[model samples]
Target: MDRRRVIDLEEFADELRRDPHPVYARLRAQGPVHRVRLPGSDPDYATWLVVGYEEARAALADPRLAKDGHKIGATFLDEEMIGKHLLATDPPQHTRLRALVTRAFTMRRVERLRPRIQQITDDLLDEMLPRGRADLIEALAFPLPITVICELLGVPDMDRAEFRKMSTEVVAPTSSQSEYDAVVRLAEYLTGLIEDKRCSRPTDDLLSDLLRTTAEDGDRLSAQELRGMAYLLLIAGHETTVNLIGNGVHALLTHPDQLAALRADMSLLDGAVEEMLRYEGPVHSATFRYAAEPLEIAGTLIEQGDHLVVGLTASGRDGGRYDDPDRFDIRRDARGHLAFGHGIHFCLGAPLARLEGRTAVGTLLQRAPELALDGTPGEWLPGLLMRGMRSLPVRW
Candidate 1:
């Protein structure tokens, strides 16, 4: 622990949130890992930000840096509001949870969902493209994945705008009380949904399958764990992809050359999405992980119990990892970018996200050849965990 040299990140919180690449560049120039105070962290709690590509990648998969906070006497909002789920567990617990969830989630792979994803994209475009001008985030990006995840989880149609409001608050709260209320509401809703599923005849939804799933040893997801899984899936499932689409489109709109290249030859659509993820990923940073025990990262000591936040956005733009890192090129070989992360905690929804992005961007370009930015993005989501626009205005 470097008690004498702690970089306070709250000092430039605004700049960091709006455009973090410059800040990441400055920090990466200094070293791979640094002890710092995040914008909204507890003042007394120590935290480190890993920025270098190699170090950030390694730290993500390091066993010493455990995902379970309870092991080190720490806790996060998710554990308190929901219950312990995949991200909040370690070892045997995590292994068991991942295995069970994987059984349910991966059964329907990305290829199987291609037609439906394309249909969803086309439907959304049909509604929005005719309007000529609209907020892309609200019109297409947000709804596509939310609809998919909700249907997968068997959530009945309700007030989507309200749900969006609640989910957004949980991820990027304006106040602690707001976040608490949002989490409570979500907890109540999921509890009711789970109970409804319990009472009703079994369905093919993931949540329903989870309720019925049992391990070889007869272990099953408790009610609390079920709710946790649902909450994680509902929130993380759509939110990350929301940004991937919003950010990817934003990158293209900002860089017309790349957009034109994609429009000229749709074959680059897949690679373009990869570059978009590399250039401006939806996940700004990996969720908070604690050092289970003392560890060394890039020659710096990360004391036991200290928190680590690997800068996914920073690593994506690492000059050492890519030539002309800051330049956005659809043709770049962005195969190893940490956009979806790497390791046990790697996003299970990567294939789904890629499918959605490819379909969404490809279909939109095919339908709206004259699409152009109507105005600047409304406002970046207010958090380091998620990087997305609240509203992306566009005209076609």
Candidate 2:
């Protein structure tokens, strides 16, 4: 067992926060799975981090690696306050919740928003381009999807600045107390938002549609379920796309050849976005997955009740899967990457994210022909869950 290394994950926090790729690459070389502690976690609080491409793909769909917080002895997130959202539940329950949300989050529905999405993108660009230089995260990357999701969910009064803080903390909590506080505040806010939606006259927004939606058995989402669904859609919808835009733009700006290739052929936009997700997906690791029973991943034995974090970013860049995995190639096939994840929990909003990503990146290139990095890299989000830049400075 000496071949397997036991390292304190916190020891690598600063380096990982800057660019986790190198660390992940080194770990993948040793093995796909590792026992490590997360930031702010106890020295003894090591969990399994799956970084190999194949191992991560299988682990994501593995039933033994469950999402039920109760099964894992979790101390951070409370299912009652958060409700059993898609990420926090398993099949049967997960199956039902996904079915309900999928009814309103259909691809057809998302496709219909293309024109409006373009209009929003164009309008945001108009405001951003004139500034000549700006932090892309604030100016464009963040606002576009937040606006799209808010309008989609019938949330017209969203405070982007406030929501960003709570959402970031929830995704990568610094401590249990901070996580609890943010979740409580967010839950309260969403609860009020849902109450208002229920009392108001029905509208065409997705949230309203969900309010009136009924299954074939005449079933409907409970008050808590509605809150959970709203919370999931509002947060997950915007966060993933935000980082996708930021990371994708950063990748392009840093790699001129690939950027020029994309600029030469705007048709490569779809593939380019796929490449971006594969190269550096927004989610560094899939949310907490706990072992329901003893199991082995990549030959490493995981004990029952052990927590697991699937390395979505590591898996996408695995050399065994992609030739020259580290190289950013916009035109590469880039298929089968686990950026949106795999199996039942695959990202529900992938279509919406892809639509937004393509529009945001493609249009930005068309408008800002001379777009370039305005400064050196900024700090990356410090956690195993979210992988993205805090801000991306850019100039046209």
Candidate 3:
């Protein structure tokens, strides 16, 4: 009999936060799958982390790994607040939710925002560029997507400062009780916001559309589903893109060769954005997927009821999938990366995210030609879910 290896991620929380790829690389050397305990999780709970690219792709679409919150029982966050969204459900339900949201988040609709996205980018840079130095995360990364998503959803009165606090707590909770409290507060805020939207003047916003839109079969989002959808859109919309811009800029500025190449030839912007996503995507790992039944991944047996984490970051940097996986090369053939995930649960806001990333990075580089890291970034966000620095200080 062999003893199974246990990697306590909580033990190396700080190190992993700063640079998870190195740790994931070491784990990949061991095997494709490892049993690990995430930071802030209860001591006894463990999840299977799929680090290999092939394995991760398969695990993401594995039917045996269920996304239903009921399958995993009670969690740190309130079920009503987080459940019933696209990521938390499987098939039929997921299929339906995706369909409804997609109608509003269509690529055509996102494309229409190109002008607005560019304007926002220019306006933000206009304000920050004059200072010659600023925390890029604050000056650009965080606000860009939050502002876009809020307007898109018709959330006119949201308090970005306070909402950000609640959103951060919901995603990267410091404790179980803290997460519960945050979710409760967020749920209350969202509920109130939805009601306010209802009472206020009608507007041409996604949320307003969602309120009245229904399927051919007359399937419309329930009040709870509406809240769940709003929570997902608001948090995921801002959180993922913020990190994408922040992480993408950090990657390029650190890799002078890549940055220089991009600067010399603007044609590489698309590939650079793809490479940024592959190299350092916003979401490090997908949310929890519990085993619906006994399953095997990369030859490792996973018992029923066991939890699993699809390592989006690890999969992107899998040595087996790409040459020099750790090196940041904007020109690499970076297709097939699982940065936005795979199968039915692919990020609904991917188009908007890409639009924002391309506009922000391209415009920033064009405006601030001498942009460089001004100071060491603050600690990385604490959690396996979101991969981002707390703040990235930079100067032109």
lDDT scores in order = 0.88, 0.89, 0.88
- Candidate 3 achieves a global lDDT of 0.88
In model 2, which regions exceed 4 Å deviation?
1-5, 174-176
lDDT of 1 by residue, 33-113 (tens): 888888987886558999999998898889889898888888777688789887788788989888888877883655677
Q: Lowest-scoring 10 consecutive residues by lDDT in candidate 1?
A: 104-113
Model 2 superposed RMSD (Cα): 1.6
Question: Which stretches of candidate 3 lie above 4 Å from their native place?
Answer: 1-4, 72-76
CA deviation > 4 Å runs, candidate 1: 107-109
- The TM-score, computed over Cα atoms with residue i paired to residue i, of candidate 2 is 0.96
Report lDDT (Cα) of residue 50, candidate 3. Answer: 90
Question: How well does model 2 score by local distance difference test?
Answer: 0.89
Alpha-carbon TM-score of each model against the true structure:
0.97, 0.96, 0.96
Return the top candidate by TM-score.
1
Candidate 2 lowest-lDDT run of ten: 1-10
Sum up the clashes in candidate 3: 0
Q: After superposition, how far is residue 198 of candidate 3 from its true place, in Å?
A: 2.4
